[model samples]
Target chain A: MNKDRPDRTPESEERRAVLGKMASATFAGLMLSGVLAHAQDAAPQKTLIPARPFKVSSDANQDVLIRMQGELERAMQKPINERRWGMVIDMRKCIGCHSCTVGCVMENKLPPGVVYRPVIDEEKGTYPNVTRTFLPRPCMHCEDPPCTPACPVGATYKRADGIVVVDYDVCIGCRYCLTACPYQARTFDFGEHWTDNAAKGADGALALTAARAYQNPPNFEYGKHWERGEGIIPKSPVGNARKCTFCTHRLDQGMLPMCVSTCVGRATFFGDLNDPKSLVSELAGAPNASVLKPEAGTHPNVYYLN
Target chain B: MTRNTKILWALWIILALMGGIGIFERLTMGERLAAYTSYVPWGMWVAAYIYFIGLSAGAFLLSSLVYVFGVHKLERIAKLALFVAAITLVMSLLTIWFDLGHMERNYEVFTRPQFHSMMAWMVWLYSAYFALLLGELYYALRRDVKNLSPREIQEDDRKLKRLATIGIPLAIAFHGGVGALFGTVSSRPFWHSSIYPIMFLVGALLSGGALMTFIVSVIWPEKDEAWLDLLQFLGKIVLGFLLFDLLLEWAEYSIPLWYGVGPEADLVKFVLFGPFWYVHWIVHILFGVAIPVYLLTWKRDARSIGIASALVAVTFFAIRLNLVIPGLVTPELRGLEHAYVDPIGNRLSYHYIPSFFEWQVLMGVVALGLALFYFGQRYLPLMQTLNNREVSK
Candidate 1:
């Protein structure tokens, strides 16, 4: 009834029409936003980077990984013995993410109890001024590895390229090498599978199927495809003493160790120590560089930059 | 069968059943059934191996007193001691063999031996000791064999005595070498000690002699004046060895703990006050040393001495457990135990307690040893001498 005075007026009619349009648009905008938020929540958040052929980047201040990859290619051209492989970890830059650990497991198909890389967490100072420190430990690959000489069967020996390799066929699995290590870096494989003790129902069967696929095709470790399975005389790595080989197979194929490439903080460096210009050699020569248990006389190839 | 024989058979069958499960688990599951992980790779089995080996060495050395040095009172028990050594040696080897990751690959120790490793050297020396044991036992048994003539019988005893003379140093080397195997691991401060080899040697003598004494007292059959004299002499030797072993233990512990500092001190503290404190305090100290020492010293009756020796032999395994576990419990690096964990498999953890399966395997090993001893006693002329050729004629 109040609108009757302006009912016939064109301006009033136009205003009413404008208000009606605005209300519907507001509701539709809110509903669309709700649907979009839900869609984002369901999607996988991890960024997938596709594998590509090695290429030296021409960009200024190239990524550490690209530079290291180029360095690795150059090192491989030299004689095997001449390339003394070394790793340098920068402690200050680490944020304690265990991506390297996961990557190593996936790359090596590591079973339970067998770990190539572990990040140690340390808390310093009193409650009010506390700061947490992360130290990612990989095998030191010592110049004088205590584990090699202790093998009664001489199954484990240092490679000409400075990597310590365990010959699965020769190793008696006496675990003397496991005991001899000063770092306690070596682990004995107890021949365990991940999907152990799962329920026999439908969901469990699905989970097991997925998990079993994860372990299949056997990991290409030590330049050989090792089908690690349980038996009387079990396959290599099932009964054999295992440790970090610095992804030697990957290195052979012009790739960095899984850990070095997986670190989010870009904290780890690997290269030929014999090359003075290499990043690892430069970082290892830094004043702050140090090794674990120097008094042990292991002369470890891994160095940490504080 | 006597009531005692029936009881032993029952005990053995139960052990066999339990041991069968353990062996079956080990074969089927590999190391999955074991509580020991990569963190503590060695476990109760390794401890048992050294314990049984020590007993073998100690018993062999005691036998030498009668055969090599001609101790007249101990002469009657020399063959018995040798038999005990042979059985216990088998038990030790079996324990170690089961403990191997690849039990089949143990032959590699001989074929592709790394002489630089103390383990290889220990294996080699013990193999020689095993050969010597067989030779000595054969010579002694040859005298009793109905096939042998009078001249051959006399020659057998002479050769047995000479073989015993050669075995004295061999026993010392092998037992001492077992100790050295643990001592030379510089990474483990608890095991790395100059006194370890000496301690192992003395421990062998005590445990071995005590077992021999206990067995002789229980089964000598005659229980006459000669038996009493033999028991008394053997008891005195055991008591001496026990005192010496205690002295070595004191040196090993007190010196490290005096400072309340250093890696050895920390490890010793952990052993003295850690989770398995009762293993050292109760099993080893109170039962093994205190009660047995009291029996040996105050109670001088043959039965009491035999009981004391039995206590020493049984509880000595606790000492072996302490030696092996403590060396491994303390982590080489801080935060290592928490760094990564295996929930399904026990091996990732630094903490270790022998699982039921491990105990079962040990029980089986013991049952097998007892069975072997029973068979040897029934078959071999271990107790009675061969028909004296001159007296029989």
Candidate 2:
């Protein structure tokens, strides 16, 4: 029995040596492939200058905002047509605070009756079974936009980056686009101001003067500085069809849309769909992602995750 | 001037004054004083535009019966019909021009027209129609311009016939294009229909025929048996078109309401039984259709026909209002109206009633139409009787 044990021990040691060699070779092969795949994945990202460099988060998941902002910065490096702008709204995260709406208003300096984003609050079921849901509606920036063709003067058009923009100077204010939109996203600027009816404060103190100053600061839309003018002949935007431009002016400066940055619950995601690594693209690929009025065949860039 | 003529002049002057005030306000206030919101982008001005354009199309088509079809009975009033068409067309253009947000930029539709847009097509078609109308009018009145040889008169008549022939299709296309402007908007389910163009054409004929009949019965200089015969003929034409228009309207209303479900059904219900139900029931049906039908079929006298025709002509405005307003009143997206409220402008709401300023502008258009018609009838040879022409020959 002692002799048999000694012989088996040598054979077992040899077997262990063979197994160890095989395991080491397999581990080496895995490490090489992983490094190669990572290099392949990050080759395009190497050229991009992230607006905010990403750090390994201590949390299990990175904040979507940081990820989206990085994606946006990366997208800005690509050609305009190569970078298709898209948005995804996480309905579950929306708290119905309407900060995005307010943010859009302030960002665009929207007058009364002109809204770029509005949160639609709906109550479902009856009594004890009732549940409330909020939907933040923004311009879809449709691929096949009905509003674009409806303009008599070619005033409105869809850009290569999937953004629909209206040339305020060319718009005749016919409002045909307003009726043509199935989403009701477009609004006509009716030359209204908050200070139209404000009281005149003793000469130059408060109210009208202050309100005028606040309202007069030009909003940079489509990367153009536009001052809201007054008088018998109204200004361009005053009589133009206005809508959310996906914050193109902000995007031009390599910044995220006002609505995206203003989202308190991180419900809104904005990034380039062309870059598969984008947060919006990842979120938009989810099974729950859908568009409003899908039957309209507008092929909206905006997605909603229910 | 007779008392009626004096009264019309007084009425026109008052309307013109009221219109001036509205025009001044519209120019200065821009769209601030207008009640239409982005939700309901069009209102009374659009309705008035379609109404006047329809009248113009109908009048032009009636004139076609005289020139193109060679109907001797209608030839006597052909010039009058042409004049009415031209003047009403002017009124339509004026009202729509005023409705634009930038009235100055309206020329852009001509300059940089997008062919894909129905509104662009409408403007182009109407501009062509307007030019053709002027040519046709010039030819129709060419012989009246001066003493002409038999050959000259014959040539003028031939030219008039050719112009009128071309005008028949031009009028139909322009008027039909107007309907298509609304119909092609797939976003508005109420207006997105194949039947709209056909319905608009028929409505134009019915309303225009009625207006002409009323004018003939009331204003024709000679109240002879021949005049009565012409009035009776026009009455029959109006009645036929009236019944046909009602049928089309029934189809428009019934096809959607048959299922009693869907968005279209809801819109139809809104038109039939909504807050402005009286527009359909009382103004359009009772006064426009029912009374006219009764008078034309039973009474058949000049007086009864006159009243019936007058009612139809006037109440047709309500028909136009129904066509334009209901298509926009409902929100494109459910709960969209409540999504955002305008605190200062109050222009975000779906609710719209044409403000007094709007009515005043319409009154101005009406006054303009009346003044042009009156001056044309008085100064031009538009009312040269067939007997006078025969004697002159």
Name the candidate that leads on DockQ.
Answer: 2
Where in model 1 is the C-alpha error above 4 Å?
A1-53, A57-60, A200-202, B386-393
What C-alpha lDDT, on a 0 to 100 scale, does residue B56 get in candidate 2? 94
lDDT of 2 by residue, B1-393 (tens): 999879977888999999989888888888788899999999999999999999999999999998889798998899999999999999999999888888889889988969999999889988988998898888777667777777777787788889888889988998899899899988899999999999999999998889899999988998999889999999999999999999999999999999899899998999889998999999999999999999999999999999999999999999999999999999887788888999888888889999999999889888888889888998888878444456655
Q: lDDT of each structure?
A: 0.86, 0.88
lDDT per residue, candidate 1, A183-254, as tens digits?
Answer: 998998888877774446579988888878886668888898899888777776788898899999999999
**What C-alpha lDDT, on a 0 to 100 scale, does residue A77 get in candidate 1?**
91
CA shift of A163, model 1, Å: 0.8
Residue-level lDDT of model 2, residues A225-285, one tens digit each, is: 8987645667878888899999999998877899998999989999998888778888889
